[model samples]
Target: MMSRVAGLFRPKEAPVVEQEILSEKTAADKEANVISHSQNDNSSPSADKSPDTKWETEEILSDVQAGIQDVEALAKVWTRWSLIVAYITIWFIYFVDAMQQGMSTTLTPYVTSAFKSHSLTAATSIFSNLIGGLFKLPLAKVLDIWGRPQGFTAMMVCLTIGLAMMAACNNVETYAAGQVFYWVGYNGISYTISVFIADTSALKNRALMLAFAASPYIITVWISGPLADAFYHGPGFRWGFGSFAIITPAICTPLLALFYFNYRKARQMGLIPERKSDRTFLQSLKHYVIEFDAVGLLLITGGLALFLLPFSLYAQQPLGWKSPMLIAFFVVGGLLIMAFAGYEKFVAPKTFIPYELLMDRTVLGACVLAGVLFVSFYIWDSYFSSFLQVVNGLDITKSSYIMNIYSLGSCFWSIIVGVLIRTTGRFKWLALYFGVPVTILGVGLMAHFRQPDVNIGYIVMCQIFIAVAGGTLVICEQMAVMAATTHQYIAVVLAIESMFSNVGGAIGSTVAAAIWNGVFPKKLADHLPVELQGNVTSIVASLETQLSYPLGSATRVAIQKAYGDAQRIMIIASTVIQVLSIISVVAWRDIKVKDFKQVKGLVV
Candidate 1:
């Protein structure tokens, strides 16, 4: 076995005719030539060789081929069982994610009440968004360098720590810190899973696998809200978060073990190349510093955080847009962002994002589409449940049920689109031609029908339509981006795509906050009777009190109308954003999903 393994790397010998020619030379010359040829052969093997060497080479090649065939057979068997395990793990992750989202949505009012601050919910959301965006690039680099198992382990550790912190928190600040950690972990894990799925599945099955992985969200959407509501009303909201902290690691252990096992097998089989570094400790530190591009991460994260900070702050601040701090944040953040662009373009030895990806029409279009669609969705969604409670007068459970129709539609259509893509091996035009128009129509209807007197059925229909469009776009855009790039860059590119989407959500939520804060209070004061004007601040601060006014009373009607007007503006903004998304879809090239070929390349 040892001899056969060594033989695989042994050089072939010269042909018989070449040996005869060498025999014709002077004995001393032939000896010198043989020495020179052996030296050359050590550096570069020759294809032309002697009969004995040829036989030896063939035997070694045959042995290596047989080994490869055996490894392939073992790999197939492992992949079949492991993929099932992986899918199960992904489903649990999605379920937990959905539960978190549901709890966050339903428990916002309670959390804010606990903090005795109206702005706490929005503040936490902005902070979470920042964390999610900030950590994605670093996580991408970690996955690239350390491989998936380590990356996944790191993410799980962060998540567990974050959840524990949240469960133990007594103050809003601590809770906010917990959220930061949780979101960072969540974003890392989510992005890693996407790349993992891409790595494990074939191109033909990737869409279906991703869609199937997401199916848990659909089920969780219905159950999580009620579960959270039960927690809120029974054992308390802390338990809602605490239970998951313990449950997540338990569910994730097997998945992590599977990843470790597969990695070990692959490494042993020589399928994975070993990374060699001979630098000193300090030198190694510097090498990694440049490799991870830490400065680029700081600049972009700081820039984005600063730029987006003011948008959320302006509405909450006493001075509003006139605040000096807001202006400074905006200006400095803008400059840092520009500096980051310049650094990437000319200064960085290795760029954090490859310029080639930016130039790819499909990738660019997918990012824009995802960004714009998120902006559109969030514009209306940021304050949607509040509207349902205040204006529509629905209870927490009912409003949650109504809101989750969107998730239901999203999950259902995502699966359908995935199957269609798998069957037809096409997605770009489906998103462009069908998804864009449907999304436009949904947002348009939402804008037109957001009045207080609008039928609940119409609202539900609009949610379903928008959700379906969102689902279609999500699957298609992901497929387009993945298909356009080689596997090496997939994780980072996906991170970049996620960054755009999260940034869009932050901006949209901020904009919605600005619009709502700017318009709602003034509208409420204007519409309310003179006697009730003094209480506008208190009323707007607490949505519960806003809904406490007697049904069918003049005050109730005025408050409802005010909410309707504000929501209409938000819906219109969403409509405009969706229209922009539709226009951007024109840039997407119709890359065939089936034709995607994984190329060998270094991670940038």
Candidate 2:
């Protein structure tokens, strides 16, 4: 019985050991199973695990959605007032340009009368302006580096001084020098502003801005022409020109202030990231100077100077085509121009112009088209007032009012075309489909213009037609050119186009003047009776002298026929050039418009 009791006590210890072993075994088994399950889950696909794993991707998608919404909201905040300000700034600058440009028409007669030479007027107007054109490329580079405000401010100051000089000048030399300063100052500042506007505006809205920019030239014509005439005759003639000294500074102050404020805003908003330059200021200046093509500048400027000098001098003194100086200017100037072309092509390290643009097919085409259009523009503008005064016997103010009709047609149609371009993403097809034929028809109609014999209503209609057609063509041309190149090359392309257009204008003016001079005098002498011929010549010599032709009679008939013939010939010739321009338009390479990225602090 004692042995049995001891066994039972030992058995209790064994039971306890068995219980502990079972628990330990279970714990080990559970840990192994968890590890194995985790490996399998990681290796294989499963629905329950996916949501937890994709959380990061879902978060990214939400962020992107929010970003897009923010962008859209920001775009909505960009108001029309910004664009309005830009338009007004451009208008102010171009209005000044108009005063200078039209000042020539009024000033020319006074200049010639003062100098006692008819040729001096043409020489001073054309050559001094050409010198200004020559300065444009360098000024553009300066604008790019120093920014528009400083460049424009400096130029305006120079221009104001130039005008003051012109107003006070007592001699022809001082007057001519003043013209040079005026041209250099005006062209450098105003032309750069045009480029600056191009840089700022989106492609879609550029035409509208440009139209507004071009508007002041037209709008000012209505006011300035009459104002110039009125003032030239008025007691305040000297004061009228001098007043610009004060007015220019007043106009510039607001623009400069805005420029500074905009620049500060751009910095705060991080619009353009700052670039670090290794060179010192002096080094940078040296680099810019060394890189500028001095030889190209010299040849090009000299060529223009030589070529224009004779043309400007021709109408004033020793009025013969075959004068030794004239022959030398034509020959030497032509040779120098060819040399400049060669230098630009083969030798220059930093070209004054981008010569490769000349070789590019699309750029070349646009240039030709712009040249023809501008040629027509200058011809009508330069001669039209004289035409109205002499042939129509209308006063300057009335003729200017009539010219407003042309401006109205242009302004209206250009806005329409700009809207069309923005909507369509197309340029040439519309012009080809609607514009070319219309322009030709307009030119043809204008060619038939005569004196009182031609219907005044028809003449006005013709002006409207030319303006509409020409406006559309120019807008299309601008769009095509802008589309062809990137921002880096736009300025040089513009400069080249301007250079060629100036050449075209010079040639057209010279040729037209020559033809008119030949036809008018000979016809006046031949048609009138022997007794009346001397009187007619005397009146021709003194264009200011009051001379009346019989109403609806033989002498008036002959004069009208002569005027009609001269105008028709010039118009027909201009039309033929324009037809060639249309052919040039066919070669433009097409570009798809891309939307501009919204810059954070852009004013417009």
Which 10 residues in a row give candidate 2 its minimum summed lDDT? 13-22
Each prediction's Cα lDDT score? 0.71, 0.60
lDDT of 2 at 597: 20
Q: What tens-digit string does per-residue lDDT give for candidate 1 at 289-372?
A: 787787787788788778877865676678888999999999999999999999988898877666667677878888888789
TM-score of each: 0.83, 0.76
Badly placed stretches (over 4 Å) of model 2 are 1-86, 95-107, 110-124, 169-180, 187-189, 216-221, 264-289, 308-319, 532-542, 546-562, 594-604
Error of model 1, residue 456, in angstroms:
1.3
Poorest lDDT segment (10 consecutive residues) of candidate 1? 14-23
**What tens-digit string does per-residue lDDT give for candidate 2 at 25-124?**
3666444221111111122223343322322122111222222222222222323444345456666767766665565455554554454443243345
TM-score of 1: 0.83
| Model 2 Cα shift for residue 502 (angstroms) | 3.0
